[model samples]
Target: MATFWIVIIAIVALLLGTVLGFFLARKYMLTYLKKNPPINEQMLRTMMMQMGQKPSQKKINQMMRSMNNQFDKK
Candidate 1:
């Protein structure tokens, strides 16, 4: 009975430690990504152009309109 309790306690402690470690690692990673965004708008546009995908002003306007609609819903 004593051994069973000890085992249960060990498992709980291990699970708690793992959860804490995961949260800490995720927080650090998100902070680092925010501090250094992977790609900027200009870089994305250039890459798209290289891939034969040219952006259009009409598409931009449509996207802006959709975004505005979303904001207005709030």
Candidate 2:
């Protein structure tokens, strides 16, 4: 009986720890991404230029808005 109770407690603790760790890691990644986005206007411009396209302001703004909307959708 004691061993069964011990097993149950251990399982519960393991589940709790897993949930806590997942949330903490998620929060950290969100904060990190906010501080350092994967892409920005300058980077986008550079990429476009490298692809042999002129980076126009209007195009840049439109791309940025679409990218932002993509993230917002998630």
Candidate 3:
């Protein structure tokens, strides 16, 4: 009976640890990504210029919106 309780406690602890670790990792990644986004306005502008197009404020905003929408879709 004592061994049974010990086994049950161990299993429960393992599950709790797994759940906590998952949430912690998720929060850390979110904070990191927000601080260092994969793309930025300047990079977009540079790309457009490289492609032989003038970067305008309106185009930049549109591209940002589209990128955000795609991220939201995921």
Candidate 4:
């Protein structure tokens, strides 16, 4: 019975630790990304140009909005 309790306690501790770590990591990433988003208009424009497509302001704005929506979803 003592060993069983010990095992249960260990499992609970492990799960709690995992949940705490996940939240901490997520918070850190959110701050980091807010400071430095994964993509920028300049990069997107350059990418479009590289792909032989014209990078218009409307297109760039649309892409930026989509990128922001993706981040918000996560």
Q: What is the C-alpha RMSD of each candidate to the true structure, in Å?
A: 5.4, 1.3, 2.4, 2.0
Error of 3 at 54 (Å): 4.0
lDDT of 1 by residue, 1-74 (tens): 99999999999999999999999998898677656656545655676688788867675456556755664464
- Model 3, range 1-74, lDDT digits (tens) per residue? 99999999999999999999999999898778767879999999999999999999999999999987886665
Q: What would the per-residue lDDT of candidate 4 be over residues 1-74, giving only the tens digit for each residue? A: 99999999999999999999999999999989978997899999999999999999999999899989888898
Q: Rank candidates by TM-score, best first.
A: 2, 4, 3, 1
* True-vs-predicted CA distance for residue 55, candidate 3, Å: 3.1
Candidate 1 minimal-lDDT segment of 10 residues: 63-72
Preferred candidate (lDDT higher): 1 or 2: 2
- Cα TM-score per model: 0.57, 0.85, 0.70, 0.74
Q: What is the lDDT of residue 23 in candidate 1?
A: 95
**Residue 4, model 3, lDDT:** 100
Worst 10 residues of 4 by lDDT: 34-43
Ranking of all predicted structures according to lDDT, beginning with the best and ending with the worst = 4, 2, 3, 1
Give lDDT per model, in order.
0.73, 0.93, 0.92, 0.94
Clashing pairs in 2: none
**Model 2 worst lDDT window (10 residues):** 65-74
RMSD in angstroms between candidate 1 and the native structure over all alpha carbons: 5.4
Q: Which candidate, 2 or 4, has the higher TM-score?
A: 2
